[model samples]
Target: MTRRTFLRAACAAAVPASLGLPALAQPAAWPARPVRVIVPFGAGSGNDIVARLMGDHLGRALGQPIVVDNRVGANGSIGADAVARSAPDGYTLFVTTNTTQAANPALMKKLNYDPIKDFAPIGRIANTPAMLVVNPSLPVRNLQELITLAKSRPGKLTYASGSAGTLVPAAMLTHMAGIDMLHVPYKTIPPALNDVVAGQVDMMFTDMATGMPQVKGGKVRAIGVSSLQPVASLPDVPPIAATIKGFELLAWYAMYAPAGTPTPIIERLSRELQAAVNHPGLRERLASLGLQPVSSTPQELADFSRSELARWGQLIRSAGIEPE
Candidate 1:
């Protein structure tokens, strides 16, 4: 089947009606205990950052604690699987990104959880583009300079990536620029960014939400953004497309619970999420982190998730990356 046709067909089957199980029993007073939000990536990732941001507000709104637990591994499969297998009660929710939901299906040869089938969409949180950053001591100051340096060093230069959103751009650059750089994979972004800060790796594409502090701290130098245009947070940085035309990638955040979660609970969480993202103070905080907070309803997130899965798959193939 054509990709669009397959996406439509597959997505049509993902509606709540098709997720068959009846909602499991929840607390007499929902969220009677501390609610746990599983963040598949490590600390400081866009997903983790937003989870804490929204979770704090959600917890306050719900009169319960929102515990953000990081279950990092396998580009998020390990944590995603944990959420997928959890009880469909409202207590255990997931705050995650495309790495586990949309991109992993294309990036992995075998996936343990069905992104569409295994989770109930709660709400979308925010979006952030990536920045190509290098250690401050790296001789190169811009994309071209970095490309020239990579060509000269060839496989001697190393780049680290913790997830697909971070990994694909560097791979695309090497493929498009015709340079050879060694790839070092990590389970999450913070440590990868840490190595870049410590000068263990030459460079990487990091989501702005997590990379901005490092950039402003002089720990790393941001040369280009993955957006078609420059980001407001780092205005002086040009689009990577300006150097290598048409290069762009964005990471997004969303909330979910195991499939079969009660509609009432999902609706309540969605309402709270909408409130959290809409709050003026929270919006300003997210903006400062380089994340654009956009709240979406459950149905909207479900449809968007389905579409993004197909789009990320196509982008992965076009970038010349093979599933592992």
Candidate 2:
């Protein structure tokens, strides 16, 4: 090669280097437009609340507005599939709860997308425990009494569930405790909880956010929490594991982008999510909703996703829950 031509090529390469710009500095140019954060649930739901909370700060951090698109249906499958099919660009993100990612795989025979492979995990946001609640008017006061009564009546007692994930915990409890209870499914917990408060259903297992309100209002009686240990917010409430040893069921939220998103983008999202969860107001709001903020690295989230998928799959198979 001629020396002049070689020098020209060398200068071309050194231009960006001398300017202190990396080859991938274009990430700094990201968000030249607004980003969309899709939540696969309706408004007023726990997932929706968290998504908005994270989006608000994430928008400020990225210097762009983070729009929360709620496309609720098919137990969050529709919105989840949309995010899975979106471009792998960092602009489109999915803020999802366990219902779509973990429970739906076993509950549905054919999902539009594979939870683990279809998207890149950004980070885990929170884990919320479900409260085992019963109508205050019931003769049974505690979990043991309720189980004993259900055993005596077999399928006479009925329990309500808002979704497959919510039901699976109760189903697992019935199977493990050797009791049979009729299942009453609802579109969401608010309605199911309304029925429970009115004594239409004998019992139900709902998230602390929904159930605690009723329990405090004298609408329902909280028997136990579906956590290995009691939560700080409900210190008096016993852990279900205390009565049914090893009984534990909880739901978690995570963030993801379409598979093949750049690793730098994933890292950026994870950092922003960690920061959002660490914010004092967001942390307090999550705690008030009975959700404990938990931020995990991408690898850590991947491992958690795998473990949860396996655990819930095993429970579904053992309980003989057929896909719809």
Candidate 3:
């Protein structure tokens, strides 16, 4: 059978008719304790912030305390592994980004857990694009000029990455542009962006959450967007694909539970997540950070995860990056 057909059939089997209208258990006894939102990034990072926001809203909806657990290290593998190995109970949920679910699958040499097998996808939270910003000292006005300069300078130009995932798109751009550039890695994008704005680094692909504000404030010059289309937050910025065909890089956030969590619990969690993102306060906050809240059914999230895993794996291998 064709891949699409197989996928549809598989999803159908997983969600049989008997599972219709999600079984609602007694709400009073459901969340007897605090719900832990495990974030695989340092505090104040985009993922952590999103988790906290959602946690607060989810807490209100469930009438329980929602705590954020920041676990940072090894390009998010350390924290992701913690969630993967956690008990299948509904209390511990992972709020993560493309780094662990998509990029790390191929970027890491030995991932402690399989992203697909170790966690059950609850829902997709948001999709945010990154901005390609250059230091004022670069003298390049647009992506073409930057490429031309890189072609001329070769390995002299320097770029920075907050993490492997943050850098993967830049590395891919370098490979596609056929230009050699030095890569500088940082633990978070904020510091790296600071260096770019201060002219310490030549250029960097930065998170739209921080980069958009800086670009608007004239702190840094935004030359292009990583995605094919201009983002709503920055409509004037050109897409990289306008100069180089088929270029796209978008960071995303998702929710997941430890594998083997009961279907009823997963459904309940997905419902709560949908409600959380749909909340106006939470939606506005995410939008301010250049995050577009996206609600996805469990099957849709699973399909999206599968596709993202395949795409990022291709990019990471082509970039020749190794996990630490």
Which candidate wins on lDDT? 1
TM-score of each: 0.90, 0.85, 0.85
Clashes of each: 0, 0, 0
Which ten-residue region of model 3 has the weakest summed lDDT?
Answer: 20-29
Over all chains combined, what TM-score does candidate 1 have?
Answer: 0.90
Alpha carbon RMSD to native, model 3: 13.1
Which stretches of candidate 1 lie above 4 Å from their native place?
1-27
lDDT of residue 206 for candidate 2: 83
lDDT of each: 0.91, 0.86, 0.85
> What's the lDDT for residue 324 in model 2?
79
Q: Which candidate gets the maximum TM-score versus the true structure?
A: 1
lDDT of predicted model 2: 0.86
How does residue 139 of candidate 1 score in lDDT?
96
Predicted candidate 3 versus true structure: per-residue lDDT over 1-324, tens digit per residue: 999999999899878655854564335466789989888877767787788888888888889999999888777888899999998988999999999899887777788989899999999999987778999878899999999999999789999987655798898789888889999888767788889989889999877776777888888888888887887777888999999898888889999999998888899989999998888988887887777899998899999999999998887878777655
User: What are the RMSDs of all candidates, in order?
Assistant: 13.5, 5.3, 13.1
Candidate 2 C-alpha lDDT tens digits along 56-119: 8899998999999987777789888999999998889999888888889888878999999999
| Clashing residue pairs in candidate 3 (N, C-alpha, C atoms within 3 angstroms) | none
